[model samples]
Target: MGASKIGSYPCEEIVVDIVVQKSEKIFGELDVPPSKLYTQFATALALLAEGKSTLKQPLRTKDTLAILRAVENMGATVKRTQEQLSIWGVGRSLRPTGNVIDVKNSATGIAMMTAIAALSPRVSVITGDAQLRARPMPHLLKVLNNMGLKAYSTKPDDSPPLVVLGGDVRGGRISVRGMNPSLIPALLIPCPYAKKKVEFLSCGDSLQLNLALDVMKAANVKVSVGKKLSIPNQPYRPFNLRVPSDLSAAAPFVVAAVLTDSKLKLNGTDLASDRGAVLLNILKKIDVKVEVSNKFVLVRGPQQPRGTKLDLSLTPELLPIVAVLAAMAKGRTTISGASEARTMKSDRISAIAHGLRKMGVKISERKDGLIVEGQAKIKGGEVDGCNDHAVVAALVTAGLFADDKTIVRNRAEALQTSYSRFISAFQELGAHVGYAE
Candidate 1:
């Protein structure tokens, strides 16, 4: 999946350049876009359901398109509309083309799709973009093999391009670290279709499994969860659902709002949302003023952020923007429990530390997290986006509060992978941002 095929921003150059924000404060109501993360996985799961599943207002982004194509390749009939996309699921009866599926830069799509492909009696090769290919997949591949898929990575380190010979899942169990985002769902989604009942032993905290379960529950698949997971062969029953606004997308604004003398009302985002809830907790712990309800999140900022011991155990995607907030805060901040971020779209912990340091931030990077002594004002300069969406977004958020000109290169294009409306959302909140036209 090339960048151009899905209408992603040009890969070679900075297509849209943003100027460093002058002293500005954003205030207003913003309707954050629906969650592409949930939309992609739910759409994939819908493709495996027994009947028509309607996804109302699903995000129309390059990343979700990657997963949609994966499901399309597996024989799901997709009907598109302005307000909805309906997937006529083939359920366990996938007509595998035995063709190689290109996921471009979405690691989760490939992982979940590979699990679905293993249920078919065909050989499926899953590949992705350079960054996606470089990500760690062997851990998930090893677990897939234990479930009897014969899944293997073409690369030595168990990275993609991954090869899976699909036939039958023997429904065995495997123990693994809890932090691999793609591992649990990749297994849980396919295990039910296995010849026998599947038991998955989570070697660490399996909180992410609850998300997979949430998607499963929405699709009408029952998964027994406790210390270990018990997956029974229950057919996915299709249903209509609307995707909530993405909290990950809303994160930059949250941090931005906190740092500026701004008040932001975020619509379409819910307090009960998994990502939003985590963010809310973190803000409260750090003393940022936030009020959230089931329908909206209201945030007021310039609250003088303070450094507190933080654990990103459940929400590692929070790392980038959290790093920005930490850099702007006024004390020692320790971020831990997110070492798994190393395998994401970028080496996030390093990317955050290095990129912020480029802006004159004092920071120390650990294997799992970061330690930062906050500065009164960030002396902004130039930083690289590392072609990671979160990295670019984080940097952009940082720029909103930086002291001087901060030129972020190559990252403006990364917004296509997650939130293409990032700049617009910021601008809606009265940010002084624009492309280098």
Candidate 2:
């Protein structure tokens, strides 16, 4: 895929120049977009199904477009309308184009596409842009090889430009015990197409892991879960469903509202699923006032916001912004079980710590997470986005609460990977945010 193709989406550019200033008052109301995770997972499952699948209100960002193209290259036919996108699946009859599939900066996209490609009895090469190429896929590739694909990384460290010769799943039993939760979906999604019944050992559970199972169940794929997880060889039936609002995308705005003591209402976000549940649980620990209706989430700043401990093992992506929220709280906040974040687009743990320290925050970076002594006020300074979208968003939220101006540097790329309208959304709320190249 070419840069021109990736940049063709209507969303904001991947690289953005962003600046934020402390705001005394800001207010807004907007709907959070669909979940990128759900969009990607459902798209992959649809590709494996036997008939047409309808995905309503699926997100159409540059990152997600990569997944769409990758699936098209793997024998799925897609038709887009104003209201929904229709996909005619290949019915477990995997076809590989053999052309190198480009996933751009989407980690989940590349992981799911690689697994889907392995079902085809042909050669497939998976690669991504510079930022994504730096992240390794050794665990995924190694597990795929064991499941009958000749998977390996082009580089020694097991980074992208991954090459796999698949369609030989000699499936009887395999163990994905202690594997990274993010990569487990890569194994489970393709197991049903194996030559024999597939049984797994040590397939741990997480929000994402359960979410994958949810998507599978929706597609009419049966996987018996017990002391051991097992999937009989079968084909996926087509599914139709609307993707839920993305809680990850709504996090920045939620944090901004909390830090600025402003009222914010987010429509279309559910408080019961995915990262939404995680965010809701985290908010209860703090002193914020949140009202949840059937259709929207309303948040108000607390008179005396305080910090508490958090375990981000299942929701590591929340660590960055949560760290910022911790800084603004009234007590010590300990965040643990997010060591996997070190291998993301950037070392988020290090990036957030360094950026907060620049803003005069009392914080300590630990191997697995961070320990922060919350302060009532902090001086604003320049912080680096480290080319990660979540880090950029987190720093921007931090800037909104800082005592003065905050400039987020190295936000030159990957800002739109998840939340393309982050800056625009804040601006609509009357926040003092702008572009500063």
Q: After superposition, how far is residue 325 of candidate 1 from its true place, in Å?
A: 0.9
TM, every model: 0.93, 0.94
Instruction: Give the number of the best model, judged by TM-score.
Output: 2
Per lDDT, the best of the predicted structures is 2
User: What's model 2's TM-score?
Assistant: 0.94
Off by over 4 Å in 2: 1-10
Per-residue CA lDDT of candidate 1, range 17-93, in tens?
66666556888777767876678778888878878999887887668889988898888899988778999999888
Computed on alpha carbons, the lDDT of every model, listed in order, comes to: 0.78, 0.79
Q: What's the number of clashes in each of the models? A: 0, 0
lDDT at position 5, candidate 2:
9
Q: What C-alpha RMSD separates each model from the true structure?
A: 4.7, 4.6
Which digits, one per residue and each the tens of the lDDT, describe model 2 over residues 84-175? 87999997787767568999998888888787777776788989998889887777777777777677788988999888776667787788
